[model samples]
Target: MSAQITLNARNLSRRLGRREVIRNISLQLKRGEVLGLLGPNGAGKSTTMQLLSGVLIPHAGQIEICGINLAQEPGRAKACIGYLPEHPPLYRDMRVDDFLLYAAKLHGVARSGLAEALAIAKSRCGLEDTGRKIIGTLSKGYQQRVGIAQAIIHNPDVVILDEPTVGLDPSQIRDIRALIRELGNAHSVILSTHLLGEVENICDRVEIMQRGQLIYGDTSVRMQSLGHQAGFIVTLQSPPEPAELYKVPGVVNVEALSATRFKILHSIDANTAEALLSLSAQQGWQAQQLTPLQGNLEDAFVHITQKQPNQHDQT
Candidate 1:
């Protein structure tokens, strides 16, 4: 791995009994970058995260963490990585302070720096005032904060979170996402999620995992542009014939929803809205409602996943 790269995995494959759940997953995470591992349920995202975090050994391939070969030096490599599995490894009976202190110690935070480590983790996760609270007594959101706190307690170079926002409410999800973004400022973070909004909002780049294969990898902005729906919906009070609407520049297709409403489709690179409005005004047709249609990330995600074949255990 290069000095700038926090994690590098080549052709990682893993098998659970007779099923090969992960296959040829080559991935790289640069320092201070947030990468989202996006896939549908049963897409092997959690399995892949386990492989990358050293929680499970790959059946094939190699992994490097901060230039240290994980297979050769698991301790040294894992020392630079912080991982929070899909179910956070939390002891419900422990107090917030106690659990975090234990986590820091497990990660080998020096005894001398343990206090500061716990304090920093708590502070970063917005858990400063919940130190004395019992882990089980806290709400779901606070428990999740504690989960994230433990992951970063040792201040590792890489932080891997599997479905961090899985069951949180809207408010909790927002808060957790903000914290993850903050972590990306200092450490390489890999977030595994099935939520498209999480990727669009939290990730810098996205790897679409399907059938244990990375079918697509790119910046979130580019990934979002995969399926482009270029068009506008307009409602005109006095509409002309469908042929008249077709005569508008850049207007390739027009669908009449009713006597007044229309769904106008244009070329991907066309500027039809302005021209359509102008034409409607000039023709004395009153335009009531005009709504621009945008290509949804959900549509793009489905499009990409459906186009790919099952890649696991193909040999």
Candidate 2:
């Protein structure tokens, strides 16, 4: 992909009362990409979305959408972006189609194009099946779909969704996730949610925030760039000195799960089975099996979030 970025924020900060909710945050999302905004509750996920959507002006910083400065050209910037908050803002008594028509008109959809815009939005979001249903009678998933439809009714270039899959059933969640994937193929998207699996599944990049500060922001591939740390699960035929195993070269740590079972940790990868066999033959050690443990994104998430750190005082 080109270096051209669609959304950029510099040193963004937002204050709620005396407390700063978002602190010196900066990130970028490219055209036709999906970025997951992940953080713990109160970690500024919602606050950051408001800043991006122009719902709340930042106390400090600059935001640009598709080369338009949001602060300098609010109208033009907002016209190119769509936002759906956690809760769908809907007239409960209005029919789905009627509500979409109202939303289209409010978005400056031309009178001549309202019908086309409404139909497109509904079809894109799978709301066509529920077009005549009253908003109040619709299920939570359908309501959320309506919210997304309204957001995209204007056909903005960028779409921001806050907790789009919250409270959804398994099928509904799958549907929404598929829809988000489809949307990301066409428009730049920012998805703010606590769902790590959803992020891992769909986001090209992710930004993790903690205590109002951005602790990590990186592409999925870049996040997995941590140097290899190897692990082996060993089943012993007989027990050896666990303490002595730690003294072996390349063996960083050893955790004994049982008198006959242990795990080996190393910062380097080598012929683990060869080492085990040689040691067993030399020391009369009984080694039945050894297997490598593959690493994955959950490992990266834990490492980045410091959820359960293996070491202390890491920067």
Candidate 3:
């Protein structure tokens, strides 16, 4: 956790016609951190990203990139960010290299630095071989890499990806996840997606939003802890009388499933658990499994999002 803040939004708000799309929101992303933006559909995730990338001017808030105020110094601040929207902006007819060159030129890369710049971007995105291929000819996965290449060609301090793996296959998704992890090691990344697994796999921290408000924001580990309700399930080799198990002091509940298996839910600490195991061992009932169920990121997401009832009268 470095002291440098790559992106910060304070009291951010936006409106679409008469409807408020984003409310008072404050967020910050540290340098070299991957912050996952999570929400259900129409949760203002896209609008937030657009505002940060300078595509949409915020209604009433401040966006700062690497200490530069976006409102006051749009060019200097925006130059430090690379944004990939849900639909990547691509020139289908242009060759990959040509398109990248055009992007580089637009970003003001010097003529002498173009070759090395293209190579770095290509290598990082695994597009070295596809540089000469027409953008439309490549597969979706390759096209995505090209999109990323354009985003990072200028080596921006912050990279924002919106559903970077939306249309890729499972294998392609894995590859993109790896790329996102690698990107975070060098530059701060704000990964926006509704896919819970994507946040679990790559993001160090996550910010869950609902109805334009940030409901949860913390490290993945911390979020998991909030959802953890420690419990264990045990199966025995020999049928155990449910009533007998329930008699144990710390036994919270007992469920008998079949002739040889039952689950004993314990309501005690580790010491009490050991005693129960020993008792099971002496009774000649083979305890098949005793594993603690830890809290996970997915559980936290469900817990937070489900509580916010949708107010949309949208038909």
Best by lDDT: 1
Considering TM-score, where higher is better, how would the candidates rank from best to worst? 3, 1, 2
Q: Please report, as a residue range, the 10-residue window in candidate 1 with the lowest summed lDDT.
A: 306-315
The candidate with the higher lDDT, 2 or 3, is 3
Per-structure clash totals for the candidates: 0, 1, 0
lDDT of 3 by residue, 138-187 (tens): 99999999999999998899999988999999999998999999999989
Clashing pairs in 3: none
Model 2's alpha-carbon lDDT is 0.85
Candidate 1 residues lying further than 4 Å off, grouped into runs, are 1-3, 235-237, 249-252, 256-261, 269-271, 274-278, 286-291, 310-315
Residues 95-204 of candidate 2 have per-residue lDDT tens digits of 99999999877767889999899889989899878998999999898999999999999888889999999999999999999999999988899999887778878899
Q: Which lDDT tens digits does candidate 1 get at residues 8-102?
A: 99999988888888979999999989999999899899998898889889999999999999999998898898999999888999999999999
Error of 2 at 205 (Å): 0.5
Residue range with the least summed lDDT across 10 consecutive positions in model 3: 306-315
The per-residue C-alpha lDDT of model 1 at residue 127 equals: 97
The lDDT per prediction is 0.91, 0.85, 0.86
